[model samples]
Target: MAGHTSKRTVGALPDTTAESPFVPVALTWLAWVLFAASVAALAVRVLFGGDWAIPGVVAVDGLTVLMWVVVTFFSGIVHSYSRRYVAGTAHETRFFVLVFGFTVTVMGLVAADHLALFGLLWLSMGLLMAKLIGLARGWRQARAAARVARRHFAASSGLLAVALAALWWETGATTVSGIAAAADTPGGSVWLVAAGALVLAAMIQSALIPFHTWLLSSMTAPTPASALMHAGFVNAGGILLTRFAPVVTVDSALMLAVVAVGGASAIGGKLLKSVRTDIKAKLGCSTVGQMGFMIMQVGLGFFGAAITHLILHGFYKAYQFLSSGERVEHTAPDGGTGATIGRVASVGGVVVTLLTGLAGGALFAVLTGKGLRVDSGLLLTFFVAFTTLHAARDAVQQTSLPAAARYAAVPVAFLPAIVVYAVVYEGVSALLTVEPVSTELTVLHVVIAAVFVGIYVGIETGVHENSRRLYVALLNAGQPSSDTVMTATEEYNEY
Candidate 1:
């Protein structure tokens, strides 16, 4: 049998000549209005250092303002892009409404001071997103994907409800700040259960491994919707943990569990991503990995670092999804001939990564006149090491430069990257007033980092001969069951 073909093109440029141009123009203007408000809110926070409150229900702090700025800025971009991308689609107006509603709910979620209000907005946002995912009315795959996402998200909502009820019952608090203040007074068992529930909710929302199928399936949605989902909504888990940091951080057991799940998801997602043939699916898997890293930062009690990672990853994923249509296939170098160079590059890259991280941490310490905290410094170092090494390996593989020049230049490139990362790390930490929780490194952190480095090196250096088998397994791991697709398709056809 021939493969099924989509009647609707995935990223085709829609004709605006026949359509009312006001739809996009109006949406774009609305997005910018929200963007301007976010900026004003941020400015007020920076200048006053006081929160703007809406009586007893909402409060806008630096974090809230910052996320507002982020969500609006990205949503504005996606809205404008969609002007041309989905201009003439049958559901263009409906698409705009869904996007606008989702954006507003997210902004509300960030600004919500009251826990009940936040929960309401959170559930609303999930519902809007599900509608957006299934917007491609007749597409069976799209409907199936939406069903998968809704099922997982509904489970997440239930967990969140339980957590919120527990928190409210224990602390007798209605607002986030109030809850945080009262959190310290709660007994150990109650706090532990609440924190555990929060972590599980985060895992489901962020699509951490085992709960990650929805993300992979969600690729059937349009690019703009996918972009917004990844960039704006997926980070809710990190935001949730950060917002409730005072409460969540008190439980060491919960923190360790977060780390364990995050570490597993990070490695697993990357493994799956490397093997995926579809570009959007690859991006989805990558989002899973990035969210894992973000959650890992939260687990390490580096809420500031987690926020930074969330923002950075959100922007990166948005850009990746928006530009996914322009992707071109590139053949990798012949492994036989490139193997030696790749191996050397991998080792050299690791050294450069370590040196860069050390230098960066030292500089940050010197400038701030504070000693480096072991956990935060190590977490930062792990990221810098892994990313820089991966980039170095890829660059060496692709470049035709002489071995001498390539080897010489790799280390030289590390100085600027390290300096920039160090500066940003310090800046964010100061701006957020994040203090290091521990001066000593834990065994778990060390083991996780080592395992990550080992896996990365094995992949980069072609040391693992069974990589092909592993990749195949990962690919199979991500595939939806045929029953799911067929059932959804049959149901849709009947309609």
Candidate 2:
């Protein structure tokens, strides 16, 4: 009788039949209006090919308008989803307000020209997101998670502040545009300091590698907030780098360092995700990797590609986070990840899969003129080819498929996806019209490529799984702090 009563009590906590708060509805409508305005801005840019700016205050360029569209669209979706998602919950009002604030703040951030305004918006974005992370005010774990996130944001803000001040001091310019205008003049110590600060700031904001713990701890946030956080908030790092592309690209050494860090985070994030049993933890780890790729694109001097990547990633991650609860857990019939672990493919089959990836990369080069040169474009092409190779490997490794079917899967299904990606890349690059940033081919590139491929092969072939120490390390590294985890049923009372 006591057990039955406890079950009833637990089930009744949700109160899903209760009406949703009105705040989210208003925010949802407003968000759509903001999205529409962004669309208008895009149309204007397309027709005029001119940036709209107030000189030292705010600016509207291709990057700004594009981000506005992506940010507001994600905002609208999150708000709309929350109308029912958080219905009757104590956090409903506060959550909607913060979401709206974050959305508008990002819109302001993308347009901000003044260093002061940009920094303020950036700081505000972090603060508001931290609050959303701790939305379950009654839950101690939630509050602890929020604190963890707040500290990370504070550190990121400080780094950005230092970068902005250094840039201003060096250039005697208080605006991002003015600083860009002064970029032709060499900045000595100040440039190095500013660029280093910018990279660190972006890294923390995007939650790459060592900075990713805050994000992992922030699973206490509501689903809609989680969606917005992953989709819109985190993408700010890429936006920051792209906005200051003129600054970051001026130094090859800095760009190379950024690429190396991005590469490490990319590989690290993937490995971390493999160790997580929780869905949100997995997604958080995945975000780190995605952000790594975005930063890598920025490091490559292809700011347009970085922007496109963030935009696409935002959409995909938003869907994943929001729809996460709908996931139905299942097991493979014969155990494992539903793939034959020891299946061997003929050498001819391996070549065909590899050739398909090469074809896709070749198509990308033709469409975007990226890989034709030995500069950073070669690495970009290699990444594309590598992705296609992974896709082909997945298809070929599926033991459920016949050998013939597996061999044909790459050209039939995956190649078109690469084509679409190339076309989009071309369109985005045209809009941004940024001169590609280049670094001379270096030994660093070769080493990075070799290490990345080796790790990937090891993981794909179950080499890493064989190492108990490696799995244990990743599992521990991916975990949130002890105080941030709910250990008791009462601690989960927030519902």
Candidate 3:
């Protein structure tokens, strides 16, 4: 009897092996088709130097082509990776279908030119995401996460509808290009109201601080789905702002509000990210921080920088989420030796970073033949400087060399990083059509930048020691517990 049972099990193994290759082959072909089409479209746009428009509804331009390349290429990679990731799953076919549908919807959203079409595609994408989140129906956590996401997305859809309708009514134009052209002549109170509505809608869609619960909870979904959500869908807010930059940039009050919300979310998200033990939840918090920084760029009138940030972050987050299964040793331990550098070294590091960054920026400007603009260029320089400072500080603390050698090595080790960033920034700026809006450095902008620097210094210098309780509270803010209610019902039945 035991030999007979073993023979039956051996016979069943071949059948499973036969079916394993089927789904992956189909998904791979689908991804290839999308990629091919995107390449063809981009070629036509570049060689022809004109947009392909479906008459007041959808248009394929340089921007659309760029996004299509990003979406299709990443989706293809994710699909191929997921084949092996979920190989033995019960509902593998269904997972493939959901991801493919989501990818198609995203492509459509990016290609949409009309406000109505864009709004419809946006809503559809949200619905598809909710379904994707609920893919693991047997898991209670998945169901709860899907329910919360659906509710938040439903609210976001409503706000988007209202904003689009207001823009359409005020401008008497349905196409994005038409509205942007009309926006040059600015309507009075109605335009302001529309801008405000759009800002609110973006805030909700991007999962800014108070509205960020759904995103953190959504870590229960499978890794592939989570990758698509973080890398693709969360970026819709930046797309909305960029698409309507001409209109949104006109309202100073609206811009200020965006800056305030984004700054708060960035700070709060970073603080929360520092305390997370779960890997996916930590990535989720990091996404919120990046989103906040992207939106803050928009508010500061650096449209080109925002777009570049969006594209780069999309690729990076996708890679992080997809490759998350591999185990890696932790380099930065709690209460580690590298946590803090002495005060004098910290100051010296900052000065070195600043000087190196400035030199790199000047070299970049000279090479590109594009003079520095105060808005985007200055902000990029500051970012490069701040990042270099962190690297320099860490290098100084971790090395076992003599003090003089360590100090000399700090700037040399970090110079390449800044130069690479500057080069990429210049290249992307060249490809983008929207120029940065010229704005003088206001006291408000300066003060905000200073506050950001201060926060970084305090965090690095252990100034939070005095407020350990507050830090702990922020750290524990979004972690799930037995008592936490993720949804109204104990078990969600949507699946």
Candidate 4:
């Protein structure tokens, strides 16, 4: 574990392509806009049923758009910070191009309603993310990350293929809707088994818990990639579950299994988050936890919660990963007043919100006997408590240490907005039976707040000493310029 520091400096953002200008920034933004439009269309479809109303596929598209928007924002921040951090570099062009390519494939994946279309897009995204990792960091370990990604992609492909084969055997068709809709009338068992197997594939991609090593290895990528993969790409698995809700809801045992995996990952993520020292690693674990929450929502038949969590977690995590310590400014010891009533109110508001969720979930669980006690709601409670305490403690310690220019106001200012938003969102969700309130949704809203608190704590405790060390590590993670693929491919052609 790395030591926590109050004063840290992020490396300057790299602009590797200023001279070459290979990929135009305008084109990048254009791609982002199209992606955003696609996402908005999907969200509208989710809100109101559409022509091609495959809810799961629609949800994926919507979430992809939202995640891409998040990445766009992060890219802007990274660009701004890099002016001072990275200065000048030749690889930035390649970096952005690969990033754009990666996101484009992800968009295609979201829009894919057919099984074959999905497989193509999914594999493409994996390839592009791996390529971007190597381009951005040039790390010796980038090759390792790429290897893990390939294994994951292959496993996913195999699972999907098995599902398809089973479908063909059962009903002589591989279409997602066709397999299930016709399953009961004729030979359905193959379709059921195939669907079950595909669910496992989704789990692998989601990085729930046991299959989380690929995600950990991916942390070696640049911050933009980390934010995109963790917050955006990883959510695809949950989106897949939501996409196949028709099949999932019918099988009680399968739904329960999904719930089980989601619960375990949520709990596991919160626990792992406590002990992690690497900044991005902590965020990655949180990504796992958030995915758990999304999966639980899908498993429990709460589509709204799944989308809402995806949108909220995606933006914040991306921002936190990219911006990090960039916003901090060292201040005099007596620059600001000590903790105020507002901070207290903010913390108190968070606690109250969490308690409200737990009470709601507990009541629902007792009355309906539907969900597990260890699902997303319970994990969210733990997240809130853990993050709030850590953030407040870090804030206090940083101020007292007189290390960096204390920008206490930055975090402190957000308190009122969070409290107000939580109150309104929860109150309204309760009032409207249309979007039935659940322990899971309540849990998500609070956890989003907790994410903010976690970032504050990470910045305060990490930016001082650890952040600089992190920068050094990140810079060193890049591979040497001369170590291109051609050189390695030729040298190891035998293997």
Candidate 5:
């Protein structure tokens, strides 16, 4: 049984192997070539394309061109990778066909300016992703997962349609840019309803908290498809919010609500991740946390920072999903001094981390000019400092290094990371060229920020482990639907 069991790595779990079926990956190669060409053309356009539009149809501005390149580059990598991942599978041809069509559909999606075209492409994206999820035609669990996803996607598209239609009718604008331009018009209830609907749609698409079940249930998909989904598809929410920042910021109350929702998802996703056992599920939770952060960035009126987060996250997550097979380890720990650090040694580590974080935050403020006031920039700077401190804490806790060396590693590792992040952040902000719709930091924002801090402290103190109900709730919250799991080998390996 052990010898004959299918390898757990890659996409081998989805389908039964065939006896040399001469898999035709020409279509995948074609998709890659087209995606590559699209990347090059879009890059050149970004250089010379000074904000032109085809009159309520397609736009060729910084946002469109940058998004096109990102979508195509990630699609190209996924397509090229899939040629090997789906080899000799029963539905290989169907898989490639869907992927090729999906790539073009997403490219059109980002470039679309008219409401109808944008909504159509959005619906198509959902359907195509559903098809990819259920690629294992003979597998019941895969089909069930696909159905669940399709339903969630349809609801999301429905909300988007309502939002777009309301915006068009109330503002009397045909294109997205036109609607955005007229966002400040006093349309009363219509504007609020439309904006609220838009937020809900993005939340569903990004898999934030309560709407996160679809993403968690989608693990039945093959690895390549999972990569594309995580690296590009789910990030549409951030892009959506970025493009429609004006509408969201029109009402201060609405904007604060967005911040609150995003904070909940970010904090909740982090807690959920600690209880998940599967590698892909853990990654899914991480995506939830990441999308939460992106949305929160948007709510804080840093659309440029949100875009940078999505792009960098795309690259980081693609590599993670693609190389997830290499993550397997034996029951026992390996490759270290096999010694744990003592508690008294940790006291010095805390001081080093604090110093490094302060230095990095100061450098970021100097480079970006964002931390002087009590606005979103100040909060963003705090987050940067907090994240840098945590990363430094991990590095300094490595027991393999001597105590002094471990403490010294904080400055050595963090300085470059902070510098590179600041540079890229400034570059992305410059590329976008659009300023925040709002930057006022209210009392509510401060309270929400404090709530975020409290959650992190509770998490670090192992409070969750002390409470059985909290741990179980988190475990259950992160699980897929009951039908999505393949319990018996025969269920998945039937040939």
Candidate 6:
């Protein structure tokens, strides 16, 4: 009996003879082709819009660009990373199959010109992502992560349905173009607000905070999912925002709603990340913060800036996930001795950050001059406080001299954006005397932009170990223990 048992156990050992069916090479190639097609479609829309409706042209152009750029880049990074990361895994081929299918659906979502089409694609992608989450191996934490992901999926789907229903009711048309037209028309406020609320659902799918719990949970998934989901599919929220930029402006309340959520999520994610321990969780939180930043930009009517931020962060996050290996180490790029900053950086980094922040704030306050209204002062103050803290946090976390040097660029880079905003807002204030542009308000915008730059520069130069710790906490925050997963599996007779 002992001999027989030994033989059975030996036979049950994982088969290492086969490679993962989901290697990303072929999938990457296919994604490239499809992405190119999307670009071509965009060019065609622009060159030949004579017969097309305005809404259709915009929808096609916007989605096409999103897929061609954001989706393609993300897919490529995930594919390359999977080659090294999952090389010997049996499901490699299966992984690629799912990734390819997911990518295709993503493209379809962006390419979708009709509301029903977009919703269907979104639902399909959500289901696939859930299944992918369930496929995570090795840790009991993975299974728990999958469950959380499913919950988020369900919520996202329900909200999307509500948005769709509202659209149908208001416009009597289900196409993207039709919905935009209806929302843009006079007396479309009710439906527009409802739709904007629904967009919040999409933002959840994109993993904005509160709804962002699932993204942290999903770290249990394979690294490939981490790269694609967090970096790639996560941008769907921004895409959706950009797609509806026109409609958002139609209703001031809707615009404010987007801004509120964006700002809240950005600040919340940043604070939470400071406490996380898991590497993936840290990156996941960063993604949320960045997405919030993008949303804020959209709210502020800077669609172009929002797009730029999205593209930069998407690729950067994807690279981090891909290059870090299974341990998800956040090492400095230079091959020198890198010290772990941990949470201590926050306390120590504050002094320098405050000085620089105040100086920058003062500059903006002067720029605002007499145009400073109460709201502008409030915004300006808020901007200065956040930027100062962010800079200090970054300075303390710097890993190498080069990284610290990069920190100096924040004020310089932001000057132009501040000047442009000052020029534009001041011009508006002059034209509409009821709300003259406050120097303080212009300073606020500059400060926000500056703070983000400071944060990213710090992140790029050196990483804090706290980022990893904070990530782990966020990832496993409310999940079951390894023992729990084992007990449940045994009870269910699952090996």
In angstroms, the error of model 4 at 184 is 5.8
- The model with the greater lDDT, 5 or 6, is 5
For candidate 4, what's the RMSD? 10.4
Q: Which regions of candidate 1 are displaced past 4 Å?
A: 1-21, 330-376, 400-414, 431-436, 463-469, 481-495
TM-score of 6: 0.68
Give each model's clash number.
0, 0, 0, 26, 0, 25
lDDT of 3 by residue, 1-495 (tens): 233444343222233335576766687679878989998887776677677779888877667887787788888987877776666677678888878888888888877988888988888888888878777786677777788888888888888888778788888998888888887788888788778878777877888888888888787677988998888888888888888888788877677667768877777777777667667888898889889888887887766667777788888899899878774444555675343224435565556655655665565555543336555346545654555565666676654787677777776766665566556666555545566664565667667778887886776676764576966787667664332234555454324
The local distance difference test score of model 5 is: 0.82
- Please give the CA lDDT of all the candidate structures: 0.76, 0.85, 0.74, 0.56, 0.82, 0.61
Query: Which runs in model 3 stand beyond 4 Å of their true positions?
Result: 1-18, 21-24, 328-377, 391-420, 430-433, 480-495
lDDT by residue for model 5 over 1-495, one digit each (tens)?
334677576543433233423333556566667767767766676576567679979876677777777877887788777766776666877877787788889888888999999999999999999999988878888988999899999998999999999998898888888887896674889988888988999999999989999999998898988998999899999888877777888787888888889989998888888777678988999899989888988888888888988998999999999999888553554566322212224679889988988888888888888777768788888877877876787787688979898887779889888889989887777667467654788899899989998987677656666778887788888888888888986787311
Best by lDDT: 2
Candidate 4 residue lDDT tens string, 115-199: 6776777677767776755554435556656777677767876886776677667666545555446645544566568768778
Q: Kindly give the stretch of ten consecutive residues in candidate 6 with the minimal lDDT sum.
A: 431-440
For model 4, the local distance difference test gives: 0.56
Question: What TM-score, computed on C-alpha atoms, does each candidate reach?
Answer: 0.87, 0.93, 0.85, 0.62, 0.91, 0.68
**Clashing residue pairs, candidate 1?**
none
Query: Best to worst by lDDT, what's the order?
Result: 2, 5, 1, 3, 6, 4
Worst 10 residues of 1 by lDDT: 486-495
Ranking by TM-score: 2, 5, 1, 3, 6, 4
- lDDT (tens digit, per residue) of candidate 1 on 351-466: 65455446544554555443445554556555655566566655555467865576667657765665665566565665563354542467876787788778766765566535
User: Of the pair 4 and 6, which is ahead by lDDT?
Assistant: 6
TM-score-superior candidate, 1 or 2: 2
Using TM-score as the yardstick, the better of models 1 and 6 is 1
Candidate 3: C-alpha lDDT: 0.74
Each candidate's root-mean-square deviation in Å?
4.5, 3.3, 5.7, 10.4, 4.1, 9.3
